[model samples]
Structures are given as C-alpha cells and as structure tokens.
Target: MAIDILVVDDEEMIRWTLKEALESEGYNVRAFENGRDFLAYFNEHGSDIILLDVRLPDSNGLDLLLEVTRVDPDAIVVIMTAYGDVETAVNAMKRGAFDYLAKPYSLEEVSLLINKIVQANLLKSQLHHYQEMLENKFSRILGENQKMKQLREHIGMAARTDRTTVLIRGESGTGKELVARQIHFQSARADKPFIDVNAAAVSSTLLESELFGHEKGAFTDAQKQKKGLFELANGGTLFLDEIGDLDPSLQVKLLRVLQERKFRRVGGTSDIHVDVRIISATNADLEKAIEDGRLRQDLFYRLNVFTVNLPPLRERRDDILLLAKNFLEEFRKEFSKDISGFRDDTLRILEGYSYPGNVRELRNIIERATLLETGNLIRPASLPDELKKSSDLGYVAFSQETAKPWQSTGFNFKDYIDSVEKQIVTEVMHEVEGKKSRAAEVLGLTRFALRHQLKKHNLESD
Candidate 1:
C-alpha cells in the first residue's frame, strides 16, 4: 500500500509544497489548512504519517499532538516548527513526535523525510504481518476436555483487558507458548506486535540489553543505538518464555518496568517510558526458585496478577484419541495417502501408552505412521517399539521353551525358523489389523527390524 501522509500545516504555500513533493514521490498525500479539519478527518479515517505545524491557527499545537497520541499511541508524527523554534521542535519529539521540519526548508528536505517515513512504515507492515499470521495460526485451540473448556474461559476473560500481566505455567511441550499467543492475538492490542523472547536462550550479560535497548557505544558490540524487546513491543505484548532463568540484576530491572512502566536503556540517562503488556511463561517452579535465591518474591507477585497453569497431556487423556485421529487424518491428506482409518485395536494401542512428550509427541507419531503407510488401515506394525514394548509389560503368558511349541514339520532347520517367524509376524499383524508400527512394538522390536523379518520370511505383501 502507498504511504498515506497527512500534512496539517496552516500556511497555504507550505501545505501545497508538501502535498506536491510527497505526491511526486508516489505517496498518497492529504493536506489540511487547520487542525480542526485534520483532527475530524483523523477520527473518521486514520493516516500513516502526520505533519502538524507547531503553531496552528485553530488549536494549540502541543495539545493537538497530545490528542493525536491519545487516539493512536503508536502514531507517527513530525512537528513543523519555525527555524528559530528548534528547541520547541526537540520538545515535540519528547512528546512522541517522530521528528521536526524547520520552516524555509527546501523541497529536497520534504523528500528525505518521506523516505524515512516510508522505511518505517515498511517495518510496521512486516510486524503487522507477523502478528496476523500468529493470531491466525492459533485462532482456536483444539480440545473438548473439561480442562480445555476452563482454559478457554480464562483466556476469554484475560483477553478482554488490554494490559494485564499474565504468568503462564506449564510443563515443557504443554502448549504454554500457544496459550500466550492466543491471549495476545485475542486481546484489544491484537493489531500491534507480539514479541517473543526466551530468557534462557541469551546470556545474562546480554539479556538485559536485549530486553531494554542500549545507546551507541554502550558496550563493545554496541556499534549503534538499538531498541530492546520492551521498546519494540510498546503498545503490544511481550511473551517472555523461560522467565525463571532471568538473572537477579535483570529481574530487578524487569520489576521496575512492570511497576513504573519506565526504564533507561543501557548506558543511557533518560528514562524511556513504554506501555508493554508482559506475558511470562516457564516450566520451572518459581516458588522453589525464589527460596533458592533464583527468583525474587516481589517480582513474582507483580507478574502473578493472573496465573495460567496448563494441564499436561497425561492428565488430559480424554483428548488423546480425538487429537490422534485428527492428526492422523491431517497427515494422511498432507502425504496424499489412501490409508482409510485406524483399526479398533490400533486406537486401543494408541490410548494404552503414556505420552511422555505430550501432544507434540502424539502428533509426531501420527505423522510418521501416516508417512509410512502402504496399506488400507493403520495396524499395530505402524507404532514405535517403545510403545509396544511398554504396552506388553507383565503379559508373558508362557515361555516358548516350557510351553507347547510348534513341532518341526520338516527336517530343514532354516525353513522351520522362517515359518515360525512368518506365523508370529502375521498373527501380530492380524491382532492389530495390519498396523505396522504397533505390531513392531508388541513384538519387542523396531519397525525396521520387523519389516526385515517379514521380508526374510516371504511374509511381506506384494
């Protein structure tokens, strides 16, 4: 989309010059003679960038700047000031103006400012795309279990508010990040950015600077000014994962930002204020960490305004087969396979095993099974060895040596062994209705190992 520039300069010549200059550069430009008409137009239709004269005929320029921000806190504004009023221009920047253009400036100056505004808009566009994609990806959480029902209710209430600090607790792979993303995308600030930062991923020395930007030459690698996640996530959500890994010093800094909503960048003196909604997640026990001097109790209280604890997959077993079948069908379509469905025995095998890796692991199992399917139904042979072996625990009905074993029908030893192998493999396959992964599991062998035995015994389907 073309950059929409709103020029609110009072002088007829200035507005005309800006309109012509910006339009010549392929921008959509609108010029107003006074602040009243511009503010009214803004209420109806918003613009990408605004150029307001510091001394307007119909309104106080500073008051207009304040009102513009109140309408859109992330509004990009450039104040137009007289050459002698440079100090006032600086003050306007402090009041959230992007920059200032001095009067008597050439048309070339207008072109330069437009280029800068265009570049900034491009960045905003990228951020908006990312936000939209995430919100769309997790638009709905899949589960009909009672736990999931309660979780949905909590998310609805939390998203209604704009700036509530949310602390999400869940075991790893329990969809904690998904919950956080849902809250951000469902909230009033969904149009803004959702910046995710893993606290444990960065070193303590650099984590502070990464969260709160640093000035130029702040550190050895600080070659230029940088904005931290907090600054970039202004008017948006900051999803801090593994938050228990935060160091003590950074924890103090974070507490200050949560309480005062302001902080100084690294090696900077000025307090940069921001409006950021913090959503922190961690698998670690914060209470134990606090007792061990790893987490501060006060910071915990500030962030614990609302707590969301996610149930693990083991605890939510009712959703297991539902999720598994859904994943199976999805992978079937993705791989373009003709596998009809899971056998009843196959579903029993799937439900019997404990999923230590949770929903993520279950999805992976289904995907692998779907990709390897070469038959009508997903049988026991399609399952992993770990699951089958674990499922067969405590079920050694008899020892082959002690119990009645199949007598040799012929004198050839190799032929008899091959016949026994074929019989056992075929029986296991029939038991689970041809699910290869599950059959391999039940026989205490890998799918690869079972397939080799099948081929060696001439039991493989043509």
Candidate 2:
C-alpha cells in the first residue's frame, strides 16, 4: 500500500525538498507552508503520516500535533525542527510524536523515518480491519422489536465463549444465516475465515467430497487435489445450512468430524485435523424426524448445545412497518426512484397479512413495488395476491387449532352470529378495500361506529 505523507514547514525550501524526496521514494506527498495552512487543508487532504516542523508562523508544532490527534487519533506524527535541542525533541516525543528528525536530516534518515511510520500504520490498519470485518459480519440483527432484542441477548450470551455449538432454527426466509453469522463473527475466531455450505444444495453423492475434499485422480471427477470447507475453515467458523436434510450416512460422517475434529479425504486414508467451530441451521422439524426414525438422536443433541429460534415475520407485527420502510428505501435507491413512502393503505395491508415467507417475502414485495410504481407512493395495486385477498376478506378469525370437517358441519348459533358479523365487515371492506370513510358510508354507519365493529372483530384495514 502507498503511504500518504504530509510535510508542514514555514520555509519554502524545506517543504519542497521533503515533498520531492518523499515523492521520489514512491510515497504520496503533500506540502503545507505553515501549521495553520496544513490544518486548513487537512480536512480535505488527510494523510497517514504528518512530518511537522516545531516552529511555524501561526502555531507551535506540538499544539498542532494535539489538534491533528483530535481529528484522527490514529494518524502518526513525526516532528522536525532546526533547533535540534534534545530537550525539545524529548518533549515532542512525550507529546505523542512517533519520532523526532533533526533539521538538515539526510535523505537516508528521512527515508528510514517514513518507512518506520508506514510499517506501524500498516499494522494498526490491519488490526482495525479485522475488528471492523467482525463487527460488520454480525450487523444484520439490529432491531428494537421484542423477538430480535431477545435474540441479540441470546447471541451475546452464547458468544461469550468458543466451546458452545450453536443450532439456529427458523423458517427458510427468517434470516437463519444472519443469526449464525452473529454467533461466529462475535466469537473468538473472528479473525479467521468463515466458510458456509448448504447441505441440501449439494447432491448427496458429492457432499462427502465437498466436505472432506479429494486427492488428485482419486475419482473420475477428482482431477485436482481439493481442500474441503472444513480444512479451509480451520481456526474459524463452518456454517452448515439446511443441515437437517443431510442424509443419514453423511450425518454419521459429520458427527465423527464434530466429535474428533478430524476427517479423511474422499479417497485418502490420512485424517486431517482441523480446529473449527460448527454453526448449523435448519428449517425442518427435526424433533418429528427423530421420532420417525430419521435423524440420529445423539447427533441432534451434540449440535443443539445452544439453540436460537427466530420468530417469523408475522409473529413480529411491530417490525413489519419498520422492515418494510427499510426495504422501500433500499430498493428506491437501487431502482433510481424518488418514491416518498408507502401509501397508508399499503402499510395497512402489510400489517394485516401473514408473511409465510417472512422478511424475504416482504423485501421481494417492496422491490417489485418500487420497480413498478410510477408515483411517489406504493399503492394497493403493488401488493401481492395474499395481501389483496386478506384485505377483501376483512377479518376472518384464524383458528390456531386445525379445523375438523365434523366441527364445521355441527356449527353452533354463535358460529352463525360470528359468520354474519364477518359477512357485514367483508362487504364493507370489499366495497372500499378497507377505507374507513367509504366503508362507513356504504354501511350507513358513522366512522366511529364502523371502527367499533372493526374493534369487535379484532380487524384492521388496508
């Protein structure tokens, strides 16, 4: 990487000389006539290192150094002075100068100082990058809703150590991968690689080779020696998605790897030992599978040391509008649209619908709406079939318990009353698609009376 160096001196000769010398050494150099001049330009033209003179017309070098630190504390400062006083150099060093270069310094001495500063800055930058990547990788779970807040707290507790095996369970579109990423990125192995593989996506015939790799010419397709994800992810995280779909034989092999932290290649005999943290995700009902003699009980127990269950989007009604608005803004920029916001009717429709596909479905809806919408708002025409159907149906009580045909045939009088109430509400909403004023006018009732019926039925409108 090229080092950016700034030269600050009142003397024109010194400024030009340092810039020329530094530029000749393949460094980006900027020159300022005085401390004030440097500060004025620093906001626009910042550098990794600043070579500052002790005495200037506007300000002292040490004071300038303090100011620069305030702007960017990581910046390296090397003080230069013609006074060549050991006491003054020591004081500058005490005030956070990386080093002090005496006036009339040789080209070799200047080059040496610049190289040292560059090396130190490079190391600091690498450390910062590692921390930043870890933080960024786990930033997908930000939310104030109760479910996400609890999930964050659970992740925090699990990330306090590296010994725990994490099992993330959620619907296919409920961000299972995001939760797994949070566990690994926040753990001790954050500096190492994070390898992800979908167990169901890879064919069972090739999964063993994919996880354990193969030696060159070991099989017809094995033309070259390949490193498996486990070996590649050594000292880091190995995220296995759709893990419940892994075949029984492959599950045994994976269990062995988890137990021994070692696996043999597809056609090789040597066992490769790797230090990896396993984070697995699955959308299937694993307990039912185990009961049906499908999944191994021991393996399930091994992987479920710490479980995090993500609530689907429908369960977190409080986050629907928040997530919808975020998606709207994201797509607005992508599609180069100047959409202001979702129409109130559109938002109402979103809040009432059951998002079977969860956040992923919501994003897709917003993206499609933003691309198709010509006006500033997302209208009812932009909503999907499920949402539009729900709006027309108004508020039908969803029975948590599956309904039986016998119960439907033997409906009580109260059930008929409920059905009648549902019919009136649906007619009103169907006439106006849930606009309170229009629905109220059609029903020959005041808006307040219509709202009273809405409350009785526990219904909201789009």
Candidate 1 C-alpha lDDT tens digits along 1-462: 357889997789888888876765446889998889999999889888998888888897778999999999988898887754867887898889988888778888877786666556655774676566555432346788999899999888889888889999987777888788788878888767678899999999888888998876788977656667787778789999999999999999999999999999898899999999999999888999999999999999988899888887767766877888778777888899998788655665566455657778888888888887789788768988666543321121133322121231223455434444555676577556578899999999998999998877566776
Q: Which 10 consecutive residues of model 1 have the lowest summed lDDT?
A: 401-410
For candidate 2, list the clashing residue pairs, or say none.
none
- What lDDT score goes with residue 207 in model 1? 88
The all-Cα superposition gives candidate 1 an RMSD in Å to the true structure of 14.0
Candidate 2 similarity to native, TM-score: 0.58
Candidate 2 error regions (>4 Å)? 1-139, 391-462
Query: What's the lDDT for candidate 1?
Result: 0.78
Please estimate how well model 2 matches the true structure, expressed as its whole-model Cα lDDT: 0.77
